[model samples]
Target: MDNEILLRLYSIYQKELYLYLYSLCGERQQAEDLLHETFLKALLALPGGHTNMRAWLYMVARNLFYNQRKKKSREILMGEQEYLSEKQTDKDLLEKILEEEKRRELYRAIRKLEQKKQEIILMQYFSGMSQKEIAAVLHITPENVRVLAYRAKKELKKNMEEFQKKSAGREDTK
Candidate 1:
């Protein structure tokens, strides 16, 4: 692709792609960097005639994220237990998003999901990707994406109901 076409593609997909990366890494600056790197790599050797350009772009961005994560994993010097516990400290960041009540509750529920389920839910629902697109980006079959999405939605509903019941019980005591 020429510079003009590539820039157009960047403009079209950058926001969602940045969100995808942000959802993976949870750092705005890192996500921005990854988004830029994704397009830079695409500019270098993008294969021609892709049926789903969005999926291709996401795949590239996701691959870049994993690569950066892998390198950081190698560099971690703490013991396994300490390193794992350190990850839990990011929960403070979660508490800061309390301005939106329902969204906060939804995110709390989503946090309880397994990692892949969280990713599937974010990609399919939040990012507006179709099952086929998510499958392509994740390197899974579309059927698998559909099945996971079904299970995730069911789990989210259950969790949200539980939250509602708890909130109601709390109100009764007030």
Candidate 2:
């Protein structure tokens, strides 16, 4: 495979691959390593050609992440509970804290989802992959992707509602 062609492929898919891996692994360094490793593997394998290069790349990356997880035997998502207590203006600090809290809550809810549903949601929303692209990667019909997405969204909504109720009850107790 020509280096030029490999570079072109990298430029096209690098950002998406990195974001997708990060969403799956939830670690920036691991995601970067996986992105590089995925492209290296692609470079070696691209001579075979592919009917759907983007989907192929996504599958390769996903497989690599899963393999790494299996080898590690245990993977723990890094938590964001250690934000520095820096001095800042009251309003700015308050707003930042609120935003981070909301993001944390959403991530917690996502983590509660089944693995496949989480993959669909992260691929579609976090990595900006189209449903058709996801269908290709997952080897499923586009209609199936839509159906899964609908069900996943419903479940996520229910989980978030439960979280809110629990939070409200906690506040009442306090």
Candidate 3:
């Protein structure tokens, strides 16, 4: 696109794009950096023009966020031994402890879901994709998407109930 069009698009969608990236990264700085990087890449590659600029921008940002996450995951796995050997005695210990507890609980609940069900739920709710859009993204029919969403919600509710029961049991023991 021309400079004017690019500038307009940037002004219009920057906040929404940043919000989307923030949701993906769960970090404001990282999201802002990614948003800047996304627009830079878009300017470089798509300067000529784009038929679907909004979708194009989203795809670029999403890909970059996921790529960073994948790299971080690999690095963490490679450093697992070192990480395990480190002692946690710093002032950050309390914050880390609470974060770990919450993460564990969230992970346990997520793990209870089937992979496909989890994907559907995350895409629909977390990614804010419409049912039709989600179906298109997943290469499934809209009817299937609806069915999956319903089933996933039911499964999540069941999992949460189980988690609550276990938590109650632990509290009783305490």
Per-candidate Cα RMSD to the true structure, in Å, reads 8.3, 1.9, 7.3
lDDT for model 1, please. Answer: 0.82
TM-scores for all predictions: 0.80, 0.90, 0.59
Best by lDDT: 2
Worst 10 residues of 1 by lDDT: 75-84
Query: Which one wins by TM-score: 2 or 3?
Result: 2
State residue 122's C-alpha deviation in candidate 3, in Å.
Answer: 4.3
For model 3, how does the per-residue alpha-carbon lDDT over 1-174 read when each residue is reduced to its tens digit?
468977998998798788767755657788899999999988788735455566677778877877898888842111011132256676567767656665666655655677556656766775676777656545678899899889878877787787779878999999
lDDT of 3: 0.70
The C-alpha stretches of model 1 lying farther than 4 A from their native spots are 74-99
Give the Cα lDDT of each candidate: 0.82, 0.86, 0.70
| Superior by TM-score: candidate 1 or candidate 2 | 2
Give the per-residue lDDT of model 1 (tens digit) for 7-52: 9999999999988888778777888999999999889978888888
Candidate 3 has a TM-score of 0.59
| Clashing residue pairs found in predicted model 2 | none
Which stretches of candidate 2 lie above 4 Å from their native place?
76-87
Is candidate 1 or 2 superior in lDDT? 2
Please, what are the lDDT tens digits per residue for candidate 2 over residues 32-134?
Answer: 9999999999888764657778888999999999999999988648444646566778897889887787788888888888888888998999888889989
